[model samples]
Target: MNHSLDGQVAIVTGAARGIGLGIARKLKADGARVAIWDLDVAGCDAQRLGFEADHLQPVDVASYESVERAFGATVEALGRVDILVNNAGINGPVVPSWEYPVDAWQRVLAVDLNSVFYCCRVAIPHMRARGGGRIVNVASIAGKEGVQYISAYSAAKAGVIAFTKSAAKELARDNVLINCVAPAMVETELFREMSDQHIEASKAKIPMGRFLQVDEVGSMVSWIASPACSFTTGFTFDLTGGRATY
Candidate 1:
């Protein structure tokens, strides 16, 4: 497939590292001007070393004002936004629903779900004016199937899946496409930060017997955000390494 994104601009949140970084790099390689937004202002500089000018910003997806301000700043810097990848999220804690922390639970939902809404709410208008745009959200397999623990993350991701569908339907008339990817376990710094026993257990559950690569997820995201992904909208593409049968 010819996945060239020439003359396009993409916004990727949580791009200081890991999957978000991978997606930004892929978009740049495909000729799109990329703007990376993350809360880690310090880390972003190191990651922005060789990228083109005016493409990094400190965006706190969990805050409405922050998101709006960041988006505004990004537009001033990158011209327009043609693609948005709502990838900023957190796995709050491994706990049952009954034991979930109120604060942590809300934080997870705010970032994982509300962030998607915030970006779409802000970017859709620009996209409509540009004639069309694409949105590819980073969901998780936990959203599809309830895991033993981590109820907060599972619930938050599930909301992302549903939001993608509903938003796609509303935006389709405007030629904006919204889709999501549900990856089971991926090899990212996020995973490495987890406990070794937990990581091993998660890997053991995957039929592929190994964690998915960040680039693999990036490739899927790039396709969903590209003009090549015309027919599919409000859909979930699996990247569970054979762990998901549905």
Candidate 2:
């Protein structure tokens, strides 16, 4: 239960607020030095966020060039990267698939799905060279069971799940563990992007009768990212509050 990550360094994307911030706080509490990576870095204060000022990185995870630069900056600032949490994403527009704009679809995939690949592509080599590491991709239950209107978000998350599995297998022998978390609706700022009807419908699907909490996600991810999660790779850990049993 004591998933101590003492002395490790973790990079959590989109950590300026919401779930990313939650995960970063948990990692820091567990003894890992955390680097908060987000586009809105100007709003993050070291004293306010409880992280080192030097470790707050302004990264655009959707861009490979930006990812590479951020990775280098993290290594230079934190000494090394032990864990990479691909948590940056957007809900996109809550419109029907047929009505979904091509531009919106591309942007959603780029941020939600492509960003994961970009981060992993840049971080895996460094982790491999350092002997081993953990990568936890934040996926969604929509990926497993596609949501109605948010086609782009669902498709992007599905790609994340598949990517995590394939990459995990490739790194299994190298001591690098890659996995994903498929969570149901969590009451974050992301809800602002959904309609009132969609919100109620999503909540109704959960047997637990409530949305997930940030701390709940943080706790699960902390365990997954820790050495305590040894022997598990290429797995999709569900945080769906009974909406998903498999």
Local accuracy by lDDT, each model: 0.86, 0.93
lDDT of 1: 0.86
Error of 1 at 123 (Å): 0.8
Question: Per-residue lDDT of 1-246 in model 2, one digit per residue for the tens?
Answer: 558999999999999888999899999989999999999788688676766543889988889999999999899998999999999999999988999999999999999999999999999999999999999999999999999999999999999999999999899999899999999988898888888999999999999999999989999999999999999999999998899999
Clashes of 1: 0
Off by over 4 Å in 2: 50-54
lDDT of 1 by residue, 133-231 (tens): 999999999999977678888888999999989988888888999999999878877875567777888889899788889889889998888878888
Steric clashes per prediction: 0, 0
C-alpha RMSD by candidate, in order: 1.7, 1.2
- Residue-level lDDT for 30 in candidate 2: 90
